[model samples]
Target: LNPEARAFDASFEVLSVEEAVRVTGRYAPLADAVRELIEATILTEVDGGVVDNARAAIEGVTESLRQRTRSAKVSYRVDGRPLPLGNAAVGVCNPIAPPIVVHQEGGGRCWSEFVLGLAYEGPPGLVHGGVSALVLDHMLGEAASEGLSKARFTGTITVKYLRGTPLGPLRSEAWIERHEGVKVFARGTISDAAGVTVEADGVFIEPAWARDGQ
Candidate 1:
């Protein structure tokens, strides 16, 4: 490999298939528990006494975990491990997430499905605008690289709110419109039972390795 190729190789760390499998088995359930806890906390309306008791219990659990772990590790999508179970935001293994589900439809297109609970509420029965954007951004970013290359960073995204996205099972999709060099243009949509509620256009920059074919 030449210097340019070396740059790409040095930039990323890829773990062996065996190690990734073990990590996923160990952490996946723990992340699911955490996600459930987050949702419970958001919707709970317990009595004051119960709230206080719960808080104390939570503090004790936190302290116990603190003694075992130092800090959070930043985990990105790995080459062989297509499921990003370790991502902090929207990762299936992360409790602090909406944990959107994604499917690659091939041909630079992707599909996502998720249900937003009360924690994501914005207007009285509607999903928050920011939450909508987050989902769109995630979906579009995935679509931009689907069935294509691996540069998947969003440069910019513009969203249009056509109607209120209700709180329940929702669908999102995105497909690449075009690509110029390292830049990809993509379009995405969020819809509920009634129809499309939000639409977005985004620009995703492929990773440096993909650009140089390293």
Candidate 2:
């Protein structure tokens, strides 16, 4: 890590990350708004001409931005982790993320929260099964590496869909169950207002670089 990125105090790092999160998070609502419009258009009785015009307008804007950013990709690192500015998925700071937006609520478990919407829908009004797995995967991996200096990668994960995950506010959690050599055992679940919907178990492995003290 460069000295400049590492020099900030822990408190300053936290605040800086928070500011970045807030600033980058502003785009999420815009994406969400567009998502809602898409869903509405799917069922709307509006004429085809109007829809075509709207689509063209949106495409023009997208193209303009793409051209403006024709340069090479920009990346930032903080506290040894990659910055999440333009991550298409799993980036809480990215507007386009379906963002499971996990937070460490306490010591024993890793908890995350998000509300599924049309953009993540499958099976008509229900959260997609694959999306559920994606959330659990990330939460479980984080749990497996909790309090460790090294990061863990998913070796294998098994998920059981207990019930249909509804499209609304939901929470997921994971905790380390045990460890065997380089592998960490973990379990996690997704829950809605009704109750637990999806459960998962996985083995997460400390990657080679981290284990080698990189």
lDDT of 2 by residue, 1-214 (tens): 4333233221212335775667557666666676667667667787889889988998997787676441234455566555544544466445446665556655536787777777678898899998888888878877786723346788999999998999889988899898899999999999998899999999998766566643
Q: When superposed on Cα atoms, how far off is each prediction in RMSD?
A: 3.7, 5.4
Model 1 residue runs over 4 Å out of place are 1-18, 70-83, 86-89, 147-149, 207-214
Please list the C-alpha lDDT of all candidates, in the order they appear. 0.77, 0.72
Off by over 4 Å in 2: 1-29, 70-74, 86-89, 93-96, 106-108, 147-149
**CA shift of 22, model 1, Å:** 3.7
Deviation from native of the Cα of residue 145 in model 2, angstroms: 2.8
Q: What TM-score quantifies how close candidate 1 is to the native fold?
A: 0.81
